[model samples]
Target: MLLLNGDEVRKAFPVTEAYRVVAEVMRRYSAGDVVQPVRTVLGPGCDGSLFAAMPCHVTGESDSGYGLKAVLHAPGNTNRDLPTHVGVVVVFDPETGQPLAMMEGAAVTALRTAAASAVATDALALPDAGDLALIGAGTQARSHLLALREIRRLRRVRLWNRGNARAKEFLQWARTHTDIDIERMNSPAEALCGADLVCTTVDTTEPLVSAKDLAEGAHVNAVGSSVPGKRELSADAVASCSAFVDSREGAQRESSELAAPIEQGLLPADRPLPEIGEVLLGRHPGRSGTSERTLYKSLGMAAQDVASGFAIVQSAQRLGIGTMTDFTG
Candidate 1:
């Protein structure tokens, strides 16, 4: 079995390569070439944390694998200077169910999630879209910045975070990494207003981005709230936009971004939430009008992590990156 730590996994899976792998798997997922169960969660137990298990099987002609990602989400870990999510993704053989590899899950989660957004942005956003607004300066914000820069030529970046110190820390980090201009915004509205592209990665139960504040033809990646009853976009914002999702069933099951508005009649009950894979596959027209508002509500999927982990394992094998051990010996 191959054992990969976070650093090894990150080294094996480059951000640019992740975009292609994630998009291919998503297309396979939407085309019924993959089997993935909706992630199951247990407890805000005594530690006020939740444990989630996501399992997936990909049966594509070229990429056949079975994988499971188990993670613990502890929101309070931020105070401890630790990652809020910690887990492992185990890749198994499709034919024999033998363990193939075990890798750090958080890195896979972050990279693939950002890659999914990049896929959505590439397929749905206007070709010339450049300016960006990032509402949340967490690890995702940094990852998205790296991922999106690959797909688009960003002219400027507007950043906002709930905490001033973290926002400042992000700015300092950004200055050292990329030469692009990044400005700190006083509020989410200030950050999002008139931006060609927007990403909301903050964990908020209430709405942060509204339709009124967004520019014409703006593309928003609503990435933060994955669980039911937690959303970052206003109901009106969701209603006003042509929504796309990574998975229709996952979105319907876990996202109030889609459910709340439809329930409130702000959005039509019969409206179609096209999968981003459909857009990538050319089965669905992504953005119809130049001025049409677009939203990609990303509910992170097990297939993405499975495919990413598989690809990373392949890369590591080729590069001799991770430690390989035989447990059955």
Candidate 2:
């Protein structure tokens, strides 16, 4: 089996290539060409960490395979200066069911999640949307900045993070990766006001963004809250926009961003929350007009990780990256 570390995974699947791979995966998933069950999340131990098992299989694709990503989400890791998400993704041959490769899951999640957002933003945001408002300064924030820049010409970035030290660290990190001017904001409202594109990547249960602050033509990628009970956007904020999701089933089961709005009757219970895939497939008109607000609720899926991992394994094979070993010595 091939073993890939975080750096190797990142090198094998850059954000640009990740965008294309994830987009195709989403399309196949929405078209019922992929088989993925809803992920099982077990959690909130004494330390408030959670573990999840996400698995999927893709059919009718050149890189069809079975993949399982077992991950631990430990928010407290920030205090320890470690990543909050850490785990491994294992890939199995579709035809023979033999384990083929194992790779770092955090890298895969970071790459594919941001790439999925970029896909949604491209399909739902206005053609020229550029100004960005980022709600958190974590790893996901950094990845989103890089991925979004590939699709849109960013004019500036407004950032808000709970910790000033972390925000400063992120600013320094940004200087090396991007030339775009980023302003530090004291509050979420300050960062979000009139921004054309907004991303919320913080780990929070309470709302940080409000509908009152969003511009008419704004597009939001709500990335932080994936589970049912946690949320980052106000109910009104979600209700005010035309919402899209990575998967309708996943969103209905796991998205806190949509749950409150749906329960409060702000977003009609029967409202159609189209998948980003549907938008990509041209089955749904993502943004009705320039004046309409659009929101993409992302609940990361197993199919994405599987398809992405399959692609990464293929690329590493051709490029001679990663360590290859066999257990049957």
Question: Which residue runs does candidate 2 get wrong by more than 4 Å?
Answer: none
User: Can you give the lDDT of residue 3 in candidate 1?
Assistant: 96
Instruction: Estimate, for each residue in 1-329, the C-alpha lDDT of model 1 and write its tens digit.
Output: 99999999999999989998999998998899888988998985588688989988888755468889999988898899999989999998767778989999999999999999999999989999999999999989999999999999999899999998999899999999988779999998999888989999987898888878899999999898888768899888888889999999898888988887888878778899899999888899899998998999998999999899889988999999888888679
How high is the lDDT of residue 214 in model 1? 90
Worst 10 residues of 1 by lDDT: 56-65
The residue-by-residue lDDT of candidate 2 on 23-87, one tens digit each, is 99888988989888899999856888899998888875565778899999888887898988889
What local distance difference test score does each model get? 0.90, 0.91
lDDT of 1 at 216: 91
TM-score of 1: 0.97
Q: Clash number for every model? A: 0, 0
